[model samples]
Target chain A: MRLKHLLASVAMSATVLAATGAKAVEIEYWQYVFETRVKAMDQLIQKFQAANPDIKVKQTTFPYADYQTKVAASIMAGQGPDVVQLFYGWTDNFISGKMIQPLRASAFPAADIERDFFPIVSAMKRGNDYYGLPTAVRSLALFYNKKIFKDAGLDPANPPKTLDEFVAAAEKTAKRDGGGNLTQAGVTMDMTGQDHQWWREVLIRQNGGQPYTDNDSKVAYNDEAGLKALTFYIDLQKTKKVGQVGFMDEGQAAFRGGLAAMTIDGTFRLGSFNTIKAFEWGVTELPANAKGERSNYASYFANAITTKAQGEKLAAAEKFLAYISSPEAMKVWLEVVGELPARRAAALTPENLANPIYGPFLKGLEYAHTTEFKDEMAQRQVAIDMVNRVLIGGETPKDSLAKAATAEQAILDRAAKR
Target chain B: MSATGTEAAAGGLWSRLSLSQKQVLWAWAFLAVPVLFYTVIRFWPTVQAFYLSATDWNVMRPASYVGFENYRRLWSDPLFWQVFRNTFAYLLLGTPISLLLSFVVAYYLDRVRFMHSFIRALYFLPFLTTAAAMAWVWRWFYQPVPIGVINDILATFGLPQQPFLRSTTQALPAVLAPAIWAGLGFQIIIFLAGLRAIPSTYYEAARIDGLSEGAILRKITIPLLKPTLVFLVVFSSIGFLRIFDQVYNINSNDPGGPLNSTKPLVLMIYQTAFSSYEMGYAAAQTVVLFLILLVISLVQLRIMRDR
Candidate 1:
């Protein structure tokens, strides 16, 4: 009887061992390192792992500066991550290189994804195939210092709504020393950072012009509308004397340090700006042009599956991607990272839409335009040259823009061949 | 019989060789490892780069022969010319100014007996520090009024705050300052060593002859310090010619910016290769840089030689 009991126990233990031997499939995901984003991703992965116990995710984050190099190198070495997050601008390069593969229709229904995500997510698609999907989208908004407005004798609550009011407010807020140099900037007109994005997406569209045309194969910003947009920008320095290029340490530093009154920045800065204690700040929709038509630039960070991933690995990656798009995951991402959710349903919810800080950025997304940039760096360089020629070189806006258009067209032509 | 035959052959081979031939054989035996290493690690890549420069390879795409297309494009490109001028400016200005400043400091500091090692260590501290850290610290020093130490000093003296790194005219000099400063320690240490190597008897003879301080420095001291000067000049010229870290860090916001005034050839090559993924074009630029470095070094060595 004792021998029989021992045999039965042994059989039961063997069954338990056999059950545990069925291993979980693991997939690697890569993202550029940002503290809040990394944390949110980790939390999302935890939720994913708990739900899908048979699937495991291995997450790695690289520094933003070297992220592209690392990803490209790894992909070329045939050791790429199963899932990778890329800037929307880089979609073409990765797609053309075959570093990333398009989502299969059966696995990821194109109709469903388009219905679930923001319209801008379609930028990741080439024809009928979708290359990637975004968890959040960022839109540009006007961030103004309340204290600066109050000191300038303007009402703190009433942010500028139109171009005329913007210039008027900027004039009041601008402070200069005895030497006629800016001590405190009224608004950041410098193209050191997002100024080019502002020029291309906001000003060009506002002035009834398109930045690019012919499926982004040609430059369209050399016309009267382009001239008008550039003149308006240059006039801020030459005519209004509100902001200058070298004023207050360049880019968003002046705004962050409370040395600049206003800056047109993105929703991604909300987390960083929240750390500022020196001044009270508020966000408003981007000011409309004289025609009363408003435009803002929206961009996103998208997650894609690499070409190296196939069969079970691809399936596991798709599962993770799906998890990232789910309302629950996006909610966590928005709360933790301060990015507006990419999904319409998620972003339109009462909690997110009702939040005073996030409301303006979300509202801007309704009419925001995201460019499917062919050569983002080259295009940006052309814009920089245009701004510099007009601002620093004392050239006419029309002449500078014509030169920029020629240069930009050459780049676009080269990209078209590629 | 087989063992005996093998021993006999080995002995015959050794005995037949001349002394010089044996010496050469032993020399080659010792040199073999380093020669193989250079061939694989250095020479091989350099040769491959020459081939790559003539092709269109963007890492992902299969490389196709493009003849001199990349080079041809580079010649017509205005940005390349601007970068070329910027690079040469760094070499011409950085080498001489840094050498003069370092020599002046080393010459004076050599005579001081109080806290000698400590002072030397202080000068050498920057050499020991990483270039990235030094660049960032200097970048802070070049900031506007409240943030920058240099501007704060200017303000203290009731001077107008200057946009050191922001101005196109000033940004290059601002970037070069830290680079020169970082290299001072190594140059000073080398200079001190050279000074110490000169026998005290020459200075004593000069003193007895009633030679003035400037005359002795101009004559005996400087004449004796030629080798050290030559080495430092060549090394520092190479350092300045390949300048990237300081410029990259200082103008981090828009690197080589404020109208690309601070751009060096290496930074341009880096951006082209990595940012644009134009490997073939980048390789062409690399070849140009290499040729420049080689020709300059040869010219420098020829000029500074003890003929």
Candidate 2:
């Protein structure tokens, strides 16, 4: 009876081993994406699973609002995912702490990937350590309502070339249907989310102001350029009334309402409004200021490997990252989801050049610059709130700038302690 | 039994140990598990929060003791004061409006309603719908544009669209209107139960005296419902004090947008902690807010006692 029981236990152990061996390897990915990118991500995951036959990808998606919290909290817990979606700004936060594992030359080699992307993509790298790879390149462009411009006796073919004209045209196009209330707005320069800081950043940058100092010593938001940008926005709300209501989200209701002639927003919002039929719209470059400088805002997501993941799992993750970032994959992503290609090679391809969806943004890219992308994650929250205070809270330019500086200093101190 | 024998029997009760006593000890052993869990999960965190408030700590770094510096910052900060003012204003407006509206509707519905339970459930719909979704729906409804419901209504009335939630002067009041709406259903049900609990003889006595319906309601019903009214006032004040999501969702971190008009204290606390990453200062703001609410509640209770 004892011999029979031992044999039965051995058989059960063998069955358990077989079950464990058949289970698929799990890979975790995190992102701040929604809609088409989310769907495309599922498709990409399915495709990779079929190709590998052993790896199973698990995705944790949050809206952009929660993504920051999730990343910081997880990283702090020392238990982040096997692979993660990173914005260029977060590179310093993770990499400088040696929290992220860097890839060697063989695992993408830098050269095989370096020549493909814009200079901004390399901004995530520090020395010889490559912390991330570009997933998508997003930049701001001027989207104009063609129908509104024609009604305002402005040439739809020729948008404003200078900041002065842009302001004048914005004011001229604004009209009151009754009782000094705006029936149609001339411009939408700001909002609360993703690109709220774009136009302001561009104008500030052009006026020889930096959101942060050159060495990142302190917030330089109170500089001349910052004041000028703030004054212009205040004038739009207070004097011109060309911008709809106060506070951009409430104010810019004119754009989506088909009343605003032009809006400076990221190219990503184009997909959200691709099927608008009430008004004919077109894209163009942001107008230059008197200093002959112009820029649209830029920000993007990247693919990064984790420190904890090992061996075959790491290899599979890298392959999946590379495949999604490939020229062909970039084409598929852009065609279906309306995302800009992270790779310059993909963006400059014949198919992409001829695509009508990308026309204005492509025109605008020559003058594009990044919004305040920070290395230390601590600075991000303060800077973001600072923008909120200025663009939404309606704090005076000086006060807002001072708040940003104070907040930024606190963040820096916290980061130093970390 | 003799008297001495009875006295000996009474003295025998003082003897230690029994089978039932041993069983009771085993039952007490069973209760220890949940008590330990409560200490760890519930009581421990409350105690830890007190200690954390005295220190300068981000999640990653070692917590440095800073004594009462956070509280000191709370005293001097204008943003903290603004949010404090906003929260108080929310309570000041929201409580009375909700209580009055709930009282009226609930009283009318209580007298005669088909499917009483169904009517109560229907009135409680706002409480049932998830807060986040309702806040989003209200966001669009409160918009100050051609698309907003109120603006469309104004257009039909031949009036210009007013800046409802975005105006400095109008934003707080306009935001309060939705909160008042959202709060009505729950308060209504509470009042309905209270009204139903009142003795019918009081109404009958009022009728015998030839009291008018309005007169009996004003004199008896309201005075009788004071306790329920107090309950709603306290709960609603707590709700309005933590006014984060509605304001946060409406403006998307532009909570006090339009010249710092709508930002509440709780929203400021959240922004300071998570957005601005000033946890120490945020904690200070929170401690101040908690004290403010506590003092107000105590004052309210004292005044209520007087009445």
- Give model 1's DockQ, 2 decimals: 0.22
Model 1: per-residue Cα lDDT over A1-418, one tens digit each? 6678889999999999667645888889999889899999999999999999988898999998788878888998899699999999888878777899998899889999888887888889898999998999999999999999999899988999998999999999998765565778889865767788889989998999999886666789999989999989889988998887756556588898888888999988887899999989999999998778999899999999999898888898999998997888889988899888998999998877778799989988988989878777767877877887776667889999999999888887876666
How does model 1 do on interface RMSD, in angstroms? 10.4
DockQ values, each candidate: 0.22, 0.16
Cα interface RMSD of each candidate:
10.4, 9.8
lDDT at position A214, candidate 1: 69
**Per-model lDDT:** 0.87, 0.71
lDDT of 1 by residue, B3-105 (tens): 6766687897889999999999989979999999999999999999999999988776668999999999999999999999999899999999999999999
Candidate 2: clashing pairs of residues: B256-B263
What's candidate 2's i-RMS value?
9.8
TM-score of each: 0.89, 0.79
By summed lDDT, the worst window of 10 consecutive residues in model 2 chain B runs over B251-260
